[model samples]
Target: MSEGDRDHSTGSGRLVTGAAWAALLLGLWLWGTEVTDVRHGLSVPATGDMAAVGRPAAAELPPAAAPLKDARPRRIDIPSLRVQAPVMPRGLDDRGGIDPPPYARSGVVGWYAAGARPGAAGAALFVGHVDTEDRPAVFHGLGAMRTGETVRVFRDDGTVAEFTVDDVQVVGRDRFDARQAYGVRQSGRAELRLITCGGTFDRASGTYTANVIVSAYLTGTGP
Candidate 1:
């Protein structure tokens, strides 16, 4: 195998550490900022500018909707990707990284229980696996989602928060910015972030080279 090819492996295993997501967890602690940066909205980086990777030139997104009361998420649906999955609360692991759903539950998505609740006035974070040992996972097609799409989060209060896709990025390991990636894009707006492993898998490192981040803002609501 060539130099880069040497990193190729035959099977997919539980690969979580070395992920750029750790930066997000660390950022939360060091920045002393709320999960959504209550003071202000975090802007996207200009240097790597991965925000519009899958956005269409003519996509016209809707304006942000009024923030809603806090409610725990029960499920998530991405109509475009045909992704409908359960949302389970997850906390940090011993290593301080997000302890996502177990590998066996790849179809389930994990929500940061301690952070902003979905439909609330903050950034609600959802994470899932891209793939497993022999099958594609819940977020396998996440990177293909484009701007102007929609993500629906069903809340325990019997309402659905409808979000409009505004940013989709494939942030590489070297350029991962926790604040920019996970921080709220607009103050007072209910935001959502769906994250998963992306880019080429490195067998040698047992991790992916990047993370696919899908950013959306609440634009409407439903019963």
Candidate 2:
């Protein structure tokens, strides 16, 4: 579970920044579709040189549900991974990159407050630490998710926005393209992105070699 925590310390800034976060933030701002085919294979892990987990050809996903009204996310539940955690709103840092949840709060997920809310019609971005100095964090199992799985977002509007996992990618730092990673896959649909440090922990660069991006879209709503 702590595969990427070796030699890392709290407040080290190596894990988050090392995952090529600056490039990710840069890509987030540009929102173009210069490239989209970033998937590598079905259920591929974000370890070693592998980049993303492609959806299976035979997977029968549900139709997209109409987007809900804007609401602040209160919590997120990923039953397949047995992860349930609070959602915190985060803003950009002075350097224009996301200010992710601090290491001390690695168990929670950080949402880009300035962007679309989880159940709204744009890609709502959430980021978390893969591992801390001693244990795996909230998104540690994110890369293992497969298509058709459910990602439920509890909102302040008293509704549960259920999303279906569609795509998973492990975007490498050198080839990091914002359009490919953060760009909307389907227009007018409510999408969710869960990102975390992935790939191997590079001792030389003091950061992870890549990032894991999980894409899901709203499929249903519940009370």
Candidate 3:
């Protein structure tokens, strides 16, 4: 999880093509339970050309609620994963890829402002650091989240949006499909994606071979 080489690492392969990430991940090896749909371990081959695993199609997912008023995500709480972090608005860099939360703010989660809000009528994006050169950060245990678990997001308007885990996938760059990771299957459905660096860390390249992506949809809400 080093990712110390550049701003965002990109390969000609399918991985860097999507807004999922551009090799912007940071960290070292982390040991614990991982959430998944296809495999058990988060480690992928050095080349990262493996097939991707993810949630089912939009038709298979439960429908979404009507879109909510635009409000920034202020906090995110996942009871099962024991993850609670402050949310920060993030925008894309010059390259059009979403900028990851700064390495210094390793404990914070970055919400893509250009994308859909947590309960809005589209795919909402959140990214965080997996780990740093020293130790684990906010999303270190991201892989441990299981299907049917709940992910709660508190917006600035004091409204809370709750989501249910539909799928958890770790996709290698070669097999990375931006459409699957960042696309909105249904135009009016509210979706959420939590992304961080995954797979085995390659010390030689200072980057992971794949990314751990969690997919969920709005299931409930509270004030």
**How many residue pairs clash per model?**
0, 2, 5
- Residue 114 miss distance in model 1 (angstroms): 0.7
The best candidate in terms of lDDT: 2
Q: Per-residue lDDT tens digits of candidate 1, residues 96-164?
A: 788788766889999988888888887888989888767788888888777788999999999999999
Runs of candidate 1 with Cα error greater than 4 angstroms are 1-14, 17-21, 29-58
Q: Estimate the TM-score for candidate 1.
A: 0.82
Deviation in angstroms for 187 in model 2? 1.2
| Residue-by-residue lDDT tens digits, candidate 3, 118-196 | 8877778888877766667788777776667789999989999988877677777667765556656455667788888
Comparing 1 and 2 by lDDT, which wins?
2
- Quote each prediction's TM-score: 0.82, 0.84, 0.73
* Candidate 3 off by > 4 Å: 1-20, 23-64, 94-96
